[model samples]
Target: MLSTKCPNACIRACHLPAWQKAEEDVKSLLKEKLLPALQRASLKAERARIHNVIGQISGE
Candidate 1:
């Protein structure tokens, strides 16, 4: 068992297994969800930019 004070100065007991589990969950979430979501958003923004450029070229 480990005890430490948080940034707010509140003392709490920490469990090793729970901490490890939380870390693994965050890693899994980033790998499985956040990366792809960010990539898709980037692609959409790029496509929109290209579309605007093409429209401007055609208008000129």
Candidate 2:
């Protein structure tokens, strides 16, 4: 949604309370830590698909 709406400008985030330091900390954690972790996990999940022959016996 951000990309579609703000194509002319860069993506913006709200980092209120400049002195809190938590804003920058959270951003770095997301970019450096969580991003890669989620990407890898997603790839593994994508590669995992059902490739078997099975049939369920209904009303058994």
Evaluated with lDDT, which candidate comes out highest? 1
- For candidate 1, the lDDT comes to 0.45
Candidate 2 weakest lDDT stretch, 10 residues: 50-59
RMSD to the true structure for each prediction, in A, is 20.3, 19.9
Each candidate structure's TM-score, on Cα atoms with residue i matched to residue i, is: 0.42, 0.24
Residue 48: error of model 2 in Å? 0.7
Across 1-60, the per-residue lDDT of candidate 1 in tens digits comes to 222334443222333344445545554454554467777566556555444443443344
Pairs of residues clashing in candidate 1: none
lDDT of 2 by residue, 1-60 (tens): 122224673222332233124434443454554467777565444333110000111111
RMSD of 2: 19.9
Give the winner by TM-score.
1
lDDT, candidate 1, at 25: 55
Off by over 4 Å in 2: 1-35, 50-60
